[model samples]
Target: MSQPELSEDELLQRAGRGDARAFDQLYDRLAPRLFGLLRQMLYDEKEAEEVLQEGFVQLWERAPSFDPERSKAFTWAVMLFRHKAIDRMRMLGRRNRLVDGAVLEQTTLGGSSQAADEALQDAERGEAVRQALNELPKEQRQLIECAFLKGLTHHVIAESFGMPLGTVKTNIRRGLLRLRDLLKGGA
Candidate 1:
């Protein structure tokens, strides 16, 4: 007799109990959609693939904690993958910023006089932004970092930080307004 196709919840339950085949089945069923989502978010095939792999690893480890009452298995999986993609994007952004800063520093220190002048202006703008960020309260700064630097949605930030969704949204709005005022005032 042929085996019946398992529902996602069934597969999840089996996988949660350490059934490798069930986990593989779940991957086979969900990988394409998850990959597509990650690709759209990350805009790089290699990074999407990496995030997908990491997501699966996380799913395997956290499967036992999956709460059907809270969300469907597929939804949970997607959330995990999305979070992983965002994290990878943030890491890449930070790395690129660091590399760019180093190159800018080198050019400023050794390049022609005109290029050095441009780099100095860039440095001053960067310093001003840094000072503005420092002036924010810690919570507001964190909200701004999550929204802008990490490219996370307010809902994701709220969920990850265990804050109310409205609170997250309000903080981001207020933070941006404050940052705008600070920049306008040349603080």
Candidate 2:
């Protein structure tokens, strides 16, 4: 026997009444785009599929509580999918070395691979900074090491390095400016 199709409202009504076929139809309608949504926030394909399945399962479990008059069925499901995507991203973020935590969170929009590539580029730029630090000349580097690495005040660094405070400050500032220009491909 062939299954009869229903309008979205009827599907939601039946789904809310515990109709398994209606739930399956709802999952079929939502799953493909939901996978993409999860995948954008999480670059892992397997994890994205799992989260997509779990979102559908929760929709089944909670469908009875959903009020269609307040929101479209698709709208409700998409919001749940987006929430799960962010939840997964947050779990992944806690494990990674996030440089700009706010930017990382804002950019992981559950949307595109282009954004992911930009985030990777930013991380690469930070790695370049570390490499640049290692290549600094000794005295110039020592000023930075004491001021930033050891968290010492500039005056303390000047006293420790046995230099006029102004000279010590200029060495650190000019060294950093040179490093910035080098990283920008200008030096």
Model 1 per-residue lDDT tens digits across residues 1-187: 9989998888988999999999999999999999999999998786787788889999999999988889999999988888898898887677457545755766667756756567777667666666677577768977887887677998899999999999999988998889888978844
Per-model lDDT: 0.83, 0.74
What is the TM-score (0 to 1) of candidate 1?
0.60
Instruction: List, residue by residue over 17-64, the lDDT tens digit for candidate 2.
Output: 999998778777778878887888788786688688778888787888
Q: Looking at candidate 2, what is the lDDT of residue 118? A: 84
Candidate number achieving the greatest TM-score relative to the actual structure: 1
Cand. 2 Cα-lDDT: 0.74
Poorest lDDT segment (10 consecutive residues) of candidate 2: 94-103
Models, CA RMSD each? 12.8, 18.6
RMSD of 1: 12.8
Kindly give the number of clashing pairs for every candidate. Answer: 0, 0
